[model samples]
Target: VNGQFVTDNGTNIFDIYKEELLKNPYTAENARIAASHYGSQLFDLAKNGFDSIPDLVLSISYQNGSLQDIGQKVNYGVKKTID
Candidate 1:
């Protein structure tokens, strides 16, 4: 592998691909990995940051923040398990 999945500067999945990973691929259907070695992927980003899980729950319980807003903070986006 040209680069690692986890790095000291955090993970940037795009940089690890050496062969122009998706530079010339046609856009069609849901994306699947070229190789089946990896199990899962996570893409997490924050602009305003987030509070702990307990604090976040409290915020939602009290109507301090909307689910959409809280989702932006703690996104549990995609979960897939392949055989």
Candidate 2:
């Protein structure tokens, strides 16, 4: 995929995640607790196993400034087959 498309998609994903975190009470609270519990998990995961990993999610940080402006885009598709 093109860089422009990836950037736009990444921004969209960020917006959606932020919106969901704001809208969902449980998510917001759990995220706060997770931040406290897993302070460096995101960075660790990123550094250790980013490309080799699959279906992993990392959150952006506001206070620590560690992952303030990071973004990515994943491209996949669904296939339907008849047996």
Candidate 3:
């Protein structure tokens, strides 16, 4: 775990893993997959302008005084006519 805090004997301590922190999460395959899924839509949005596109909202909440306990909610959608 990188940049994570661990509780030991009722004490919270920062745990840093250099190797995990330095690892790259993005890969060529991930890029290709993202492009395959949203390339056309993104291009269209750029060309048409994002005025009509709905705003994306993300909400994150945590509880139990634990970093492991987390929740997220996302709202995203777009409506456009392509002809």
Per-candidate clashes come to 0, 0, 0
Candidate lDDT scores, in order, read: 0.36, 0.48, 0.42
Q: Which of the two, 1 or 2, has more TM-score?
A: 2
Tens digit per residue, CA lDDT, model 3, 19-81: 233344744436555544555665565456768698876554443443321233332223323
Candidate 1 lDDT tens digits, 1-83? 23234557775454454234445465222124642223222222122223322353433322324232353445432342233
Between the candidate structures 1 and 3, which one is better when assessed by TM-score? 3
Ranking by TM-score: 3, 2, 1
lDDT of candidate 3 at residue 58, scale 0 to 100: 50
Off by over 4 Å in 1: 1-4, 12-15, 24-83
Instruction: Provide TM-scores for the models.
Output: 0.19, 0.29, 0.30
The global Cα lDDT (0 to 1) of model 2 is 0.48
The regions of model 2 sitting more than 4 angstroms off are: 1-19, 50-83
Model 1, CA-based lDDT: 0.36
